[model samples]
Target: MNTCLRPVAEQDAAALFTLVDTHRAALASWLPWVAATHTQQDSLAFLQHSVAARQQGSQYDWLILVDGQLAGVCGLHSVSAANRRACVGYWLAPPYVGRGVMQAALQQLCGQAFGPLGLQRLVIDPALANVRSIAVAQRAGFGFEGILRQHLWLHGQPHDAASYSLLATEWAVRQPVQA
Candidate 1:
């Protein structure tokens, strides 16, 4: 599939909300904010916040398009410019799952992170129980670091998370050498 990442725009609120609403149960199980996104307005607010954050050099979010259709979202959050590190987050619609769409999107994100973004490190912290998410990180060449106890609170309960990271050096070694 032709996978691409488009910067999130105000006009995408409806599409984003529809995806979250349709997958509320599954998404809410892992993401605490999912429960609060009950309407298009909430998604718009999120997009607005993302725009502001991007402008402030704090966070960046993008819509994942597969074959020219909205399929999911991916972003770099919890950015630390001083430390040159950031954490990655992503999710795909049910129909797009298992197709390597997220994996490809992540690779592209990594390229930007390690190249123009001038970031040295990127991390993915997936709840220990989230095997699919962990797999995605592994597929994108992130090495497992360790488990963080109560790293995330979801659905009113704390959950352990498996931390994974990729450094720019590692990513460079994985890339094809330019001719």
Candidate 2:
């Protein structure tokens, strides 16, 4: 998919907003933040918040670029330095789906999280009904931990979530050793 991850910046507000606006319906189906991001200003606000979170060492967000174009967004959320863990979340534009772009991006992100970041564990919590997200987590080698009933409030409504996790040890074991 020729995918790469870049730190999201304030300059991306317009493009990010356009992407979200284009996929509002699809994204809002599972991601609550979609509805809230109605304009460029909203995108700017999100980028600002992401920057602040990154500075605080609490979260790291990235833009998924496929073939040099903005394809989606992915990142480590709710990072806990003390626990050496964080949750992963991502969403791709409609046209970029089924192209393995997200899978490649995720694999790279996981590598960074467990390698340079020295994280011990990573979590993926997707709504139970979100089959695509579940498949992405599985394809990334995240193990199913169980379901968290009514775990998230989306658009002011309760939703069940399927929890998945991958440990640093498991990731290391799955990696191909270089000669």
Please give the CA lDDT of all the candidate structures: 0.92, 0.93
Model 1: weakest 10-residue lDDT segment is: 23-32
Q: How would you encode candidate 2's per-residue C-alpha lDDT over 1-179 as one tens digit per residue?
A: 58999999999999999999988888788988887887899999999999999999899999999989998999999999999999999999999998899889988898889998889999999999899999999999999999999998988889999999999999999889999
Write the residue-wise lDDT of candidate 1 on 102-168 in tens digits. Answer: 9889989998889888999999999999999999999999999999999999877899999999999
Looking at model 1, the pairs that clash are none
Clashing pairs in 2: none
Superposed model 1: Cα runs more than 4 Å off? none
TM per prediction: 0.97, 0.97
Whole-model lDDT, model 2: 0.93
